[model samples]
Target: MNKQQLQQQIEQVYLDILIELNLEKVDTYFAPDYVQVTDHITTDINEFKAHLEKLKAVVKSLTIETFKDMLIDEEKQTVFLRYDVIVEKKDNSIGNIEVYAVFTFNDDGKVIACNELTKEYDEQVKGLGSI
Candidate 1:
């Protein structure tokens, strides 16, 4: 697929898996041997799914606030994206976070590897404090 197509696919996957918390759709975007590296841990596809499950348990809702930037390197088959997110917890607390992620896709356009960094802001009172 072309760079534009790949970028759209990546965005769809993020919305489906991250924002929607649809673990069942993971295989549509991630390869069987997917690997994820983050500040706290590195995990394979199964482990990543488990991690998402844990997150879902604590988070009541997640929404992407903005797509700050996106860069695609066709030659490297990699895409980098920066975005902001708002997370609502089960206890009704809200948190805003900024994320930078890099995804490497296989020839089939399935994501085989990913690395990300996230900075979470302090909790905010409803309709009050800045993110």
Candidate 2:
């Protein structure tokens, strides 16, 4: 697949992260040996799924607003995406912010890794003494 196709596959998985609790969808999108490297965390495919499961239990839905930035390196199979996310919770609360995201897909069009740099609204509130 080309760079666009690879980004599409990665974006789909991110979109599905909130809508579906089915791990198999992730399994289908991500290579079995996928390795994720985040700003503060690094994990394999299974470990990342575990983190998603925990998130799914608390986050009711995720709304993403993505901007198609430059394809940083087509040859390297990577894309730079900028997005805003609304992380919905059960208590009628929302976590909203924009962040930078990167996704890399394997040769066969499965996402090999995904990473995001996001800011937490609650954490910001805490800094302002509103936690």
Candidate 3:
């Protein structure tokens, strides 16, 4: 596929992953040896899925913004997306957050690696620190 097509595919995969959390069509969207780079460290695909499971407990719902700004690298099969997100909590509270992600895809159009950046959109309510 072309660069734009590859990027769009990865972006759609991510949207599905986040909205559904803890469960994903990994084989369809990612290589078995997928890796992820985060603000803290890098890990394999399984590790990333486990991390998502943990995150799901805290974030009930997610809304992504600025999808049109996504960048793609077809030659290397990479995609970069910078977005804002609204997260819903168990208590019906909501927080806005900013996140950036880089994705690398395999020849099959499956994501093989990813790098993600995240930050709270505002100071945490009740002095919890941040979103």
Q: Pick the candidate with the highest lDDT.
A: 1
- Each model's TM-score, in the order given? 0.89, 0.78, 0.83
Error in Å for residue 52 of model 1: 1.0
Compute the lDDT of residue 74 as modeled in candidate 2.
72
Q: Runs in model 1 with CA error above 4 Å? A: 123-131
The best candidate in terms of TM-score = 1
Q: What root-mean-square deviation over C-alphas does model 2 reach?
A: 4.4
lDDT (tens digit, per residue) of candidate 2 on 1-131: 67667666656776665456566688777888888765556788778777777766666766766564645567888877776666676666776756576777778777777676665566421211101
Q: What is the lDDT of residue 43 in candidate 3?
A: 87
Candidate 3 residues lying further than 4 Å off, grouped into runs, are 123-131
- Tell me how candidate 3 scores on lDDT: 0.71
* Candidate 3 positional error at 77, Å: 0.6
State candidate 1's TM-score: 0.89
Query: In model 3, how large is the Cα lDDT of residue 21?
Result: 62
lDDT of 1 at 110: 94
